[model samples]
Target chain A: MKEQILKNLSNYLELLQERFGHEKIWEELLISVAEYGDSDIYHNSIKESLEKILEVMKIDEVLCALDIITDKIEGFPKEDLLKYIIYIKNEYCLEKENNLREVKEALTELATPIIRIWHDIVLTPLIGTLDSERAQAMAEKLLLFIDANKAKYVILDVTGVPYIDTVVGGFLMEMIKAVRFLGADVVITGIKPDIAHTLVKLGVDFNNIIVKRDLETALKYVINLIEKR
Target chain B: MQERVVPIIKIYDCLVVPIQIELDDTTVEKIQKQILSEIENNDVKGVIIDVSMVDIIDSYISYTLSETATMARMMGCYTVLCGIQPQVALTLAQMGVNIKGIYYAMNLENALEILAGIEE
Candidate 1:
């Protein structure tokens, strides 16, 4: 492949130069094909050209480039060229997936923290929409803290949460059930009007678990219970 | 399978059961029987079962424990489940396994305190 590319290098340059207008990228692509056609440098060169081409040129132009190189250069395997481009595309997709996974992991960590707020009471601020996985995680961590600290009350503040549908409401109930079984009462606060409207209209009962308007009222109610005890 | 006996240390009127072995179906049943018999024979006031060392407690084992607690309750003795590992508790919570008729305390000390309060 290297020998074939070197043999018809000048002709290939002329064809690409006509289409690409004497750009330095064509020279880099040619040298990489000649010296390290099967190596990582050629891989990077092909990747760079595709990114650059996709930036300014249309997809048809790219397809035209593919046709030009494969036809103009004698004995050049189109499969090998396709292999490089496909591999580059696969790597790009995997890189994007990896970044997405990292972002999800970070969001989960930040979202599900059960922090101690007051004596015999721990508070967890529920941010983002609630799902089964996140609610299960938050419940697990909150239960442990309640046991370890012997917390008598759990205050779930949903101030940052944007929405809570019926399914999310069920998850919330499950978590609340688990907390109560541990001998701790759960106090949920900070329901938006739209969420409260939906929750009541859906017949999702907050009658069992104590619901307060805000964290301050919830804390005051807990304190009142503590003193009454 | 040979049944291994978990030691039941009598601390005053309350019995302290520290479960140090892996609990299979047969072993769990056997332990429950032993605890019930020990409670009856000794006229124990309260029972504190520490499960910090036990890694897993399935639905059946937890049900058996709850049954034991209920039975003990009828016999005028309280049962306090102590030191449930965080992971085990999470599994139980996620499974929605409600352990009725038993009080849960974080550790042995808390368990003893619960016993003292119950006896009073």
Candidate 2:
């Protein structure tokens, strides 16, 4: 009976390995969160990525599952970990995969019946991690959006962002540059104190990217710029 | 039946092709050739390409895209690159690829509006 139990454990280990191929744990967690309500393509990738993370971390199966599932949820219940097992398993088995591709699709998903709001004024709201990949995508989208809309002013609100590194900071500068090139003024908002300190420490110059304390102030600033123009 | 031949949506009377993958030399060439042919065969005023599907575009691809837009304009067809991912835009900016004079839109719908306004 002990040997049989060991044999079953080995089989389970193999299954876990197969699920996560090569992705990191954090990526798996993030991807899982994103893919929670998506299709099979996304669903499988998240599972596989998570599985790989679990194996690489060499975490206990039960504990690993608990952690990943909790991370996947926006607001995980702060109850006993055991009590959450069923919920975790349900989410793990049923949730879809959320990958970079899905995010891209989501960004452009606003294509139908296009918002023809006056380009004479524009607002490009940015949210989440301002990593290089996401920054570039946002820059391109905003520039094109601004040019297409012929907006005189573009407002970039980063209130939802947790942090900004050099690469991302540089991307913000790029957006300002592109917006100005298209004859539009840019107003930046949501300058968190920590983010400000990080930027200063990086020795990066935000001398040009117009910044404001919050979205409300930035909105007012943008309105002033547009009116003047 | 075979997959339906997607209708060529008209934007500024130009054929706006929505790309569904990363932009590489080969894909850009394929798109360029398609645009050239469409320009010659149809009264395409411009091309608005949606590249949000593209996660990464190397400098070479960026160059080609810029060149293609210029070529389209020279051929009497304006080009608009729409729905570029924000991150991609940042990279392009760092690399100093001036995608100027090339109309850009946040999405296909926005692209269409830009093209339509220009058409009017």
Candidate 3:
């Protein structure tokens, strides 16, 4: 994409210079606009490159270029400039959205981190609150991991979690059930007092799950279970 | 007259099924029958169906499999499904199949391990 942009750079800059009658032109600005204005996106880096333009070029020349493009100048080719602005604006919006989506994906992965703490055991330390989307994402990851690793036990640590409602409790149960289907036992540890109270009040059953007081107890219990088996 | 869809090899008391062909509704139904009969004939304690080579398993096919596992459970035989492709698993999970009455494993070895555990 960058190579393609470079190939068309001369023609595009020549056209702009001919239309605006600006003898001194900024090649980097045009390239940056074309480059960052395409599929690739690092919003801050693009903005920083734009800021770097102020250090090297005269501010008035840049302003004049902007004004002409924005249709402030008399007898400016109105249609083509409008089309260019529309295209750049649309591309900028799309690039920003892509950037946001990437951040969201990374955040989801970071939020529900699953660590293989030992042989036949994986530990997922739950952080923050749970929503349906986040819960489903976590469930998919956990289920696949269980199947791939042929895991024997999973310790879910929720000590960092602030609260758990009935909805959250349901999500946890569903995740546990999916893991069970994959033939791996799940041991959820580190339930806070508030979460425990919420769980009890909600009348959630603990028959299917093995819960321990802390991470240490959970690991010891799993080791013992493994040994006996 | 229908023929057998996949070979069912016996390893210890467990029947290992590697289903490599594409499964139409009829094929899966036949496979189900084959597995059930093998359970009775061999006194099979467990069945492991490997679907790694199969590319796709639609809703009907999955339903047939679930039913077969249920039937096997009633016959005092455990069913463990192994090596389901990632895409198929995603589709099944989205279809909201609980995959009840059946277990899952990573591969043949793991499936055998699960069956051995159940024996204990």
Query: Which candidate wins on DockQ?
Result: 1
Error of 1 at B64 (Å): 1.3
Question: DockQ ranking from best to worst?
Answer: 1, 3, 2
Compute the lDDT of residue A20 as modeled in candidate 2. 40
Q: Who wins the lDDT comparison?
A: 1
Cα lDDT tens digits, model 3, A1-229, are 4565467667656765775544233465555555565543444444544455444456565456666543522333334333444555577689999999999888889988988888899999988888778877888898777667777799999988999787777677767765664557789888888989888887766887899999999999998988876
lDDT of 2 by residue, A188-220 (tens): 787788778877886755665677888787777
State the TM-score of the second chain for every model: 0.93, 0.83, 0.93
- Model 2 chain B: ten consecutive residues of lowest lDDT: B1-10
User: In the order shown, what is each candidate's alpha-carbon RMSD?
Assistant: 4.2, 17.8, 9.3
TM-score of chain A by itself in each prediction: 0.76, 0.49, 0.67
* TM-score ranking, high to low: 1, 3, 2
Q: Give one digit per residue, the lDDT tens place, for model 1 in A1-229.
A: 7877877777777878887654566666666666655654446665676566555666577667878787766554456666766766688799999999889777877997788877888888988987777776677777778877888788989899898877777667767766765557789899898778777876755666799999999999998988774
lDDT of 2 at B8: 46
TM-score of each: 0.80, 0.42, 0.67
lDDT of every predicted structure (CA atoms): 0.78, 0.61, 0.75
> Model 1, B59-89: lDDT tens per residue?
9999999998998888888999887776676
- Candidate 2's TM-score reads 0.42
